[model samples]
Target: MSPRRRRTEEFTSYYGRPILKEPTWEALDIAGYIFAGGLAGASSILAAGAQHTGRPRLERAAKLTAITAISASVAALVHDLGRPERFLNMLRVAKPTSPMSVGSWILSVYGPLAGASAAADVLGIFPRAGKAAGIGAGIAGSAVATYTAVLVSDTAVPTWHDAHAVMPFVFAGSAAASAGGIGAALSPLAEAGPARRMAIGGAAVETAMSFAMERSGRLSAETFHQGRAGTLLRLSKALTVGGAVGIALGGRSSRAVSAVGGLAVAAGSALLRFGIFEAGRASTLDPKYVVVPQRERLAARQEEPAKADTMG
Candidate 1:
């Protein structure tokens, strides 16, 4: 009998180099920007809601969170750009077609509004102006929370680009969860109701979207399931779920529990952003994550034409 032959698939590149260049973004800076931006944006929204509902403490905490987080987010972005002027240059042109341009504009508008709102809350001056600014910040914050998703997905990274459909939803959920966490942690027990609800709801949405994105079974999705990215994502999910549960159970009663749970949720949100950033970078390291998907698409297109010819 002839010896049996086994065939294995291997992905290689010219000189074993990656097909795509890895992103030059610093992990800490960019990932921190993503986390802080989401947190700030959602906190602005929560602040408006709290103000409308007459929750004074919650409103103040949320406002403070919005301004602080956004400030940190801007700092991270500027640091990553290597020059503060680079950020300002992005604002000179408003290109609706470019996520970066739109995002730059959003940050510029949202920052002042958030600062005014926070200043009003802290300094107890210009209450009327602050309220109006808070509302404006809320409106802009909506975009700030999810715009990063669009910004990153607009890139050539396989994992991020491929997951575009669900990326915004994931970011929105993460933002809400983190904002809720901060609110709950800072607010008194009597005023923690809304924060707890937000935390639970956000966690649910984030968890569902994360699962859906990963379960798509695409080759790139594998980056999210292996290595450091995988570990970080897994931990993020656990902390988010645990934090949500803790808030649900003890948030209404124990101040200590609520604070711990809220912090956990925020930590999880940060880790989720980091994990996603890592996954996108990891996707660029291996040629298979890029080449295989393109080859598959090409094969499918060729098959479609052959089928059409046969039908004709």
Candidate 2:
């Protein structure tokens, strides 16, 4: 084939321009990794605050949860990479242009510290200074969670990119709530106050951000309110409310309540990721999402004569 024809045959953007594919189910799972790390980090912060306030149980709960969640987050990330060997390749050529590439480096740095801090606590090694590790790890973990929002938002996916302004807060809120629910399940009520409080705050933020995202763009919002995306939004709202109420009532004191509620928030967050990913794919599948806006822009441009032509 001629060079021009060869180049023409290659896949490109939705509109025959160069752009990445919409996120897949695998990508959704990777997004969950981000959600988990964020929750883990937020939990650590809450626990640290509890520790400073003389709440040993909350502190321990936070420390343990951050470690466990971060580990899970890393596991999901590796699982998404399709191979462990290729994971480090992310760092080999730090591409600021690619969000996933940057996120890989962030996770790599944060994952180990989170595991080590948790291990130190579990083994009682450096128990005296393990608190320091918890603080550090938790902060890094939070960054892991929130930064993914930026990663997804920076993409060309209409649903993901259009929701850029509110996506981070939504992810952060969901993460905080998930960790708090876990803490409530594992820690005593008195010490779990911080976690419970976080749950409420997170639920509110997630809900608000989601609403804002829907309002920000019609196409993006359609993904959430239609079909499976609608189902996720519905489930997320129900679970978020239930979890918040459970936390407020000090459900942590009850294992069943804690277990059920925590799982709800965690599941809800994962669903949100899937919903977002699917929506991006759906947006790409229909030319309306891609062409409508571009057509409007062209028509507007055509109506406006060039400066030189208009002046003549």
Candidate 3:
């Protein structure tokens, strides 16, 4: 392949611009990601709460959120594809190296299982089935929440590659925090202990991961640390801190505080994805990141051949 084509493949994007210039999407995509995160995160919080207390409210919230999360995951995915017909094409290959592919498969499993659990809850029939569905939803929702970290990490960009190991936890935390924020706003303050804890914990995790992703120096680390990403990083820290504090202070039922905190965590999570997307593109734009890493691989591959020939 020509150097230009090769560079494009490694870097990402149609050209120098972002794939979604305005980041505009159908309502489904927008709501789906949020719902998915909320569902999974909320489900986790409820599950945790269930361990301590068996309030019917918490259980109801968890079941509803998990189902909603799964539904949104599916909707967001379909919207992401831009065409209902293109869905199956995504599964043509199971490339371990491809984050999008891996994420798709994960979401596919998480979506249906979680939705079924919620559906069971909606219907009064089959108490046994509802329990089974809830378990399935919990498992699937958690996966949907965490795997996004790997999705970002799987990219060839400097910022993402360097922080691969930590991103999953970060995503998981952010998702949970988002759920907690929502629950706190809607649920009674006294009963919101689980939600508050989850939100605060999630915020902390996201803040740390965002810092780590920015601090790494592989290639586009600067990209993440300057300009838009820099702004985002600072914003994430502020929001996470603010949100965590707000949740921990026992005032979550306040509409204003909860709204701000929820928006903050959600923004942080979304920006994380956006920043990574841009950073990957930037890393690929320059020939050095691609050439440098691949060259090292080739060199390592060549050493084995040379050593074998020498021995022979």
Candidate 4:
């Protein structure tokens, strides 16, 4: 065959079948679940910190938010499964290699502790027990905040797989910002100092890591700049940066400023999750993304044999 015909043939596939499996998740369900789960996890930590510091109002608000967010996260996960009963199957075995199984177990532990802590605080009963549960929930929350990153990064999606290292930090920071936003929104300005600071710090960390991921030069990075994902992520970055600035300027002295900043941060966190989900899906849909890297891998393997033969 002529060189031009060979090149053309290389680009074509039978029936134009996709080279990689598209993610079988709905944006509303999976993306929302990721945001809510992160929020719940970080809120548990905030609740524990508030309890330790004797901030009753902040503690109560954080605890309630943790429980509520986790519950909603579970609902979203189940909804994404199409059949709610399939969620139970995940609980049947604990597989270390499977991020979903591990995440399910983490959620199970976190949900009960969060619920009990919130309930005990609300009922004004067993303060010591509630504090202990809050601490446990906080530890579990860390897993929840970061595990979803592992879940996505473990997949075949080029962007997500290449982003394994930074994605966890991004998600964790976003979670902290989201939790802080919720706490700040619920507390008085004077009591919201820590939450505001957390929100700002988290936003800074999240923004830096996200920028790093986008500029890493991986083929998958194209997904972040091309379409709906790009639009949403750009908006997320603007809102996050703007909210952090707002908090830095007036969060401590003005309730209105704190509330607006908090809302912006929370909304940005949600958008980040949705944008990431969309980007991963877009990466899988393009055959070039799946083919080029694999072709390079094969070429590298072929070179290894020739190099060894030459050395011998």
Candidate 5:
């Protein structure tokens, strides 16, 4: 060889410019929308279970929480879109390939059911109809909880796209944590058994999944541990774990402690969403996040042919 080839120490775009455009979505609106949607979806499932178990206080609280969270979620989405009717316009057609379309449909269907169930529960009218609506809402709510993960992961954002495998599980766990949190906070200690258990289980899952995602060695995974994203994620994990512990220890003894723990869990869930959003955006801003992965792939492809030649 005339000269030994040296691997580049770092990859960069021309003039050190970013290769990918950052997402235009506002962090507050989108992150809040995600948090609320997850809270609503998971709360509906809890509501259905509470209904079946004859925990009327838990059931009614969960139902009300579901409707209110979903309403806030939809309002945030509409506000971001800058038009309320734009949401309705999406219902005109169904597109299976589009996460936005599917999510819109899910929201449309779940919203009415949640609203009807909550309204009937509060008004003490149409008990049978309300039960039916609650069941229907619970079914739709499962999709509502996890679809946002798919929606974000489907985008070109490196951090989000790379975490696609774990994102849904993360979202699902977070949703359950938030729902259980609210229920435990609002319901009496005797009726709050299920909520406390749910919060603990959800917290465990959320923590484990997030840790796995971060350690999976994806290039963009670094974004999660750097800067604002890092701060938020770390705090979220602490609060979630601490909250779960508090719920486990104090739920049976003290109402104030249980409520505080529940609030902490809910706050942690919200921060997790915001942290993930910030991580994705941060990845887009850095040229290395885009360039390095592409270079690694190109190197791998080049090595594949050489390996084949050696075998020959």
Candidate 6:
């Protein structure tokens, strides 16, 4: 008789159940929080820059926008929690190893500074204090802009976890783009030149980082190319590209064109955040994603000893 052929066994989960816990965050609340936090963070920096340059209108606009966005983000975050009052517990301890803890502290510090700065601008109180608060807000805002990536990546979600290295760059770029877009839309064309330049640079960085993320060899990269997540991300890319082109060609000449471009960039940033959130959720629903990578890792570990032995 011919030698029996060996059959390869496939890894399987019980009843095909997911091997990982699904994210419990609501799409609207959590994703909105992400967008608003980023916008607020970047806007704070813009406000400080405008202040230094003596652009009163742009400074005022950015300060107000930053305050509003951060307040909204805080509200959204509270609304997302199962126990809203428990949110304060995040501030109880400062754990450098915990991204969530770090983020809470960042927001707490940024919020007061941002609010004080905006209030000072509106009430014309304590010019030096306002400048100091604005400066502090700008510094803290940089942390706020990028720390959300750390928050998400700290989770078990495959796509978010695997993309940790590049996720901060992606978030920072998107934050800058959104802030620039808002600045461009709200400020005069003459006062908005810096915003326009910031938008272009931010969009370029955001687009390149996103492309690199999707091309990374992680299996989770597939999440960006299929399903609802795919559709939104694809639309985000298209809008971002189109908006960048419009800004490049007409940003200097037409306020209307610049406003439209800015709006597009803002919309793209929102969509990208929502899409990433959805993709991470989708990844958890699949057993293969959870099981396969882990199995491969285990196999690789097992092979290491043999390779060491052979080398020795």
Give the winner by TM-score: 1
| lDDT of each residue in 1-312, candidate 6, tens digit only | 311111112546899788788988899899999999999999999999999998888899999999999999999999987676768988889999999899999999999999999999999999999999999999999999999999999998998999999999999999999898888888898899888887888889999999999899777888888899999999998888788789889988899999999889989988999999989999888877776777678989999999999999
By summed lDDT, the worst window of 10 consecutive residues in model 2 runs over 3-12
Residue-pair clash count for candidate 6: 0
Write one digit per residue (lDDT tens) for candidate 4, span 129-243.
9889999999999998889999999988888998998999999989999999888889987677778888999899889999998887776787887799999999999999899
For candidate 4, what is the total of clashing residue pairs?
Answer: 0
Model 1 lDDT tens row, 253-274: 9999999999999889999999
Worst 10 residues of 5 by lDDT: 1-10
Candidate 3's TM-score: 0.72
What is the RMSD of candidate 5? 3.1
- What are the Cα lDDT values of the candidates? 0.92, 0.71, 0.62, 0.89, 0.92, 0.90
lDDT per residue for candidate 2 within 179-253, as digits (tens), equals 777776677755666766677777778778877887774544677787777777778778877777665564646
Q: What is the per-residue lDDT of model 5 for residues 229-309, given as tens digits with 9 covering 90 to 100?
A: 999999999999999999998877888988999989989999999999999999998887766778779989999999999
- Residue pairs in collision within model 6: none
- TM-scores for all candidates: the values are 0.96, 0.82, 0.72, 0.93, 0.96, 0.95
Candidates in descending TM-score order: 1, 5, 6, 4, 2, 3
Clashes of 5: 0
Give the TM-score (vs. native) of candidate 2.
0.82
RMSD of each: 3.1, 7.0, 6.6, 3.4, 3.1, 3.9
TM-score of 1: 0.96
Of the pair 3 and 6, which is ahead by lDDT? Answer: 6
| Candidate 3 lDDT for residue 106 | 69
lDDT of 1: 0.92
